[model samples]
Each structure stands twice: as C-alpha cells, then as structure tokens.
Target: MPTLQIREAIREAMREEMVRDDKVFLMGEEVGHYQGAYKCSQGLLEQFGEKRVVDTPITETGFAGVGIGAAMCGLRPIIEFMTFNFSAVAFDQILNNAAKIHHMTGGQFSVPIVFRGPNAAAHMLGSTHSQAFDSFYAHIPGLKVVSVATPYDAKGLLKSAIRDPNPVIFFESELMYSVRGEVPEEEYLIPIGEADIKRPGDDVTLLCWGQSVPTALAAAELAQEHSDLSAEVIDLRTLRPLDTEAIIASVKKTNRVVIAEHGWPYGGVGAELVDRIQRLAFDWLDAPVARVCYDDIPFAYAENLEHLSIPQPEDVHAALRQVAYRD
Candidate 1:
C-alpha cells in the first residue's frame, strides 16, 4: 500500500485508463501545457502526447460540446472544468446534449465522457465559485454523478466512471487534493451506486459524501468521547441512482439519521436522502431525520464567514447529538 494525495490518485486513474484504451483522451483549458489549474494532470502531456492530452481555450461550452461530439463518434473523452462554477457556461451541452443523446437515440449512442474537476467551497473563493452543484446534476435523469472524499475512492470511482457507457460528472474538492490516504497498488474499480460505511455504529447514521464524509467521521469520533453512542457514517459515492438500500439498512439499524452536505440546505443531495429515508424507511425511524448543510447565505470572502458558510465538524457533532437524543 502507498499513501497518495487525492489529486495524484485521480491523475493515476486517468493516465492508466488512457493507456488501456486508445479511445480515451483528455481535453480542457490548461490541462496539457499548464498541467491543469490544480496540477492534477501534471506530466500527462508528455506521457500521452498533445493528441491525447489536449489544452482547449478558456471556453467551457465550446470544449464541452466538442467532447460530447467526440464521445458520439466512439471516443471516450474526459473534460475538465477549472472549477465546477465555470461549468454553468456549458450547462446546455452537459444537461441537454450529453445527458440525452443515448436516450434520444434509443441507446444507439453512448457518451462515455467524464466531466470532472474541483467543486464546492474552498477557503474564501466566494459566492460564485464556492457553490456545490452535485444535487443539480443528480436531479437529471440520464447523467451519473460521483463525488469522492478520499484517495482510494477517487482512483476507484474515476476508473469506473470512465468505463461506464454514459456521461458521468466526477466532483473533487479543491481543498482535498493535498489530503493523503492509503491506496493499493493493484488496479481496482468501485462500483457505481454503492454506499460505503466508513464507520459502523448502532445509535445513529450520518450520511455524507465528498468532503463532508470525513467531517461526519470526525464528528463520530468526537461523539464517542461524550457517550457510548456509535454513529454509522455512509459515504454516498454516487448521487444519481443513490444506493438507497444501504442508507435504508443503516437507518433501520440505528433508528435515527443525520444527513450532512457541504452545500446549501435547500435542494441539496442531503435533502433528497432525507426525503427517500422518510419514504422508504419511515417505520424504522425512531425520530425525525436530521440534516446538516451549509448556511443558505452566499459564501463570504472573509475567512471567518467562509468557515461559518460550510458545514463544520462542530455542526455535524451538534446535529448528531440532536438526532441521537431526540424524542
């Protein structure tokens, strides 16, 4: 086993996939010469050459449309957005074209493309760049969405997304790129639509994904210090086609759940999880399901205000206590 940063793991996944499949290629602004805005694609240009690792202009819409067209022609293209905030410029290409082509053609075309990059609030990046759009993509019927929190999941899930015969939106956190975790040397692929329980518990369930997964795990550690309350933490690796069975099963055992997300409280992935639990596992719950999310206000540039904007460990711990002790 080797400890690798989340960014390195993602780069390795892309490099290996490109080598394995001739149809696989990468294109985005600064992806080739600049080695990616975050350097996640460092050294890829030299290894894969310009044809495979391309640098497009700063036009997300144009490049995204190009990637969709390439996928239709039997190429697997990985498109990177400097940040997901910029992806809004290409929303029509992503939401309408890439997401609908296969269905519109009655499975005659498969868009095996991956649109990925840093997502969510990082430091004081402010209102425009700090938002999380995982729920928005998950709401779409044809697209598959994945947000990974650790190096292991980053490698495994990205590999899986690249191979799937559909468009996948892979989200990585800018702040998490440097975080290190153990990753096995052997090749592996974590299946889509599967939930992983990072920590097993009997008292409460903390459902989270991406950066919030680790935040919930930390809250579970702190909760152990206060009482014998064990918290089950579920890492929702995929948003669309959510592994509802895993979540429902966890809630059935714990009898209470607290869903956490790094996005706004309304119309977030956490809201959907809570809604599903009530619909599917209502009888199993002992108390009302609780949710932990970023404050509804736009993210502020000030560091202190930014800290309050996103979900923190203390917020998760408080939510856990509230759910655990609820009548």
Candidate 2:
C-alpha cells in the first residue's frame, strides 16, 4: 500500500486507464497544458502528448458535446469540468445525449464516458462555484453517480467509472483533493454502488458521502465523547445506484439515522435516502430520520456567512444526539 492524496489517486487511475486502453483520452479546460485545474493531471500531457491529454476552450457545452460524440464513435473519453458547478453548461449533452444514447439505440450504442472534476463548496468559492449537484446528476436514469471520500475509493471507483459502459459522473470535493490516505499499490477496482461502513456502531447511523463523510465521522467521535452514543458511519461511495440495502441494514441495526450532505436541505440526497429508509425500515426506527445539510439559501461569499451555510461537525453531533435520544 502507498499513501496518496485524492488528486494523486485520481491521476493514477486516469494514467493507468489511458495506458491500458489506447482509446481512453482526456479532454477538458486546462487539462492538458495546465495539467488540470487542481493539478490532478500533472505530467499527463508530457507523457501522453497533446493528442491524448487535450485542452479545450472554456466552453463546457462545446467540449462536452465533443466528448459525447467521441464516446459514441467508440473512444472512451474522460471529460473534466474543472468544477461540477460549471457542468451545468453541459447539461444538454450529459442529460440528453450521454444518458439517452444507449437506451435510445436499444443498447446498440453506448456512451462509455466519464465526466469528472471537483464538486461542492471549498472554503468561500461563493454561490456559483459552491453548489453540490450530486442529487441533480443522480436523479437521471442512465447516469452513474460516484462520490468518493478517500484516496483508496477515489482510485478504485474512478477506474471502474472509466471502464463503465455508460456515462458516469465522478464528483470529487476540492477540499478532499489534498487529503491523504492509504491506497493499494496493485491495480484494483471498487465496484460502483457499494457502500462502506467506515465505523460500525449500534446506537445510531450517520449516512454521508464525499466531504460530508469526514464531518459525519467527526460527529460520531464527538457523540461518543460527549453522550456515550455509538454512531455507525456509512460512506456512500456511490450515489446513484445508492446502496439502499446497506442503508436499510444500518438503520435497522442502529434504529436511528442522521443523513448529512453539503447541499441544500430541500430535495437533497439526504432527503431521498430518508424516504427510502422510512419506507423500508420504518418499524426499526425509534426516531424520525434527521438531516444535517446546507441551509436553504444561496451560498454566501462572506466567510462568516459561508461557515453558517453548510452543516458542521457540531451540527452533526447535535443531530446524532437527538436521534440517539441523548440530546
């Protein structure tokens, strides 16, 4: 095993995939010459050359459409958006073409593409750059949405996503790009849609993904320290093919759950998970599912206001205490 940051792990995945398959190439703003906006593609351009590691104009829609067309023509394209918030400009290509091509062609044509880049808020990037579109992308039928929290998961899931037959949305958190964790040196792939129990407990469940996973784990630690509550923490490695079974199982054992996300409260990923939990394991729940999420408002540019917008560990701690009847 080797320790690597999320960015390094992602770079390794792309590097390996591109070397393994000649058809696999990268195209996005600043990906080639700039070596990726976040340096995830460092040295890739020099190794793979200008042909494979391509840099496109700032137009997300234009490059995104080109990527889709390339994928349809049998090339595996990894389209980076710089940030997922910018991906909205490519919504037509992602939702209309990449998502529908396979089914529309009755499985004869497939969009073997991976759309990836930094996602969610990092520090005070402001409203335009801070939105989390995981829920939005996950809602689409043909897309596979993956949200990784660790270096290990980042590498494995990304490899799988690149090899997937359909379009996959790989959402990375800018805040987690520099976070270090142990990743296997040998090649590996973590199947999408599998959930990992980061911490096992009996009192309550904390369900989260991406940056929120760390927040939930911190909250779990605080819960144990302050209230002696054992909180089970589940990292949803994949969002779309949500591991509903894992969620139901955790809720059944803990008898309570608190869902946390860095997105808006209304119609967030937490809300959808709560609905499924209530429908599948209502009888096992001792309290209503609690959600720790962003306040329903446009993200503020001010530091203080930004801090208050997203849920914090303290908020998760409070939610955990309540769900555990320890508040």
lDDT of 2 at 107: 92
Candidate 1: tens digits of C-alpha lDDT, residues 39-130 = 99999999989999999988999999999999999999999999999999999999999999999999898898999999899888878999
Give all candidates' CA lDDT scores.
0.92, 0.93
- Candidate 2, residue 285: Cα displacement in angstroms equals 0.7
Q: Candidate 1: lDDT of 1?
A: 86
Worst 10 residues of 1 by lDDT: 318-327
Residue 252 deviation, candidate 2, in Å? 1.0
lDDT value for candidate 1? 0.92
Model 2: pairs clashing at backbone N, Cα or C within 3 Å: none
Candidate 2 versus truth, CA RMSD in Å, comes to: 0.7
Native-structure RMSD, model 1: 1.1
Q: After superposition, how far is residue 221 of candidate 1 from its true place, in Å?
A: 0.9
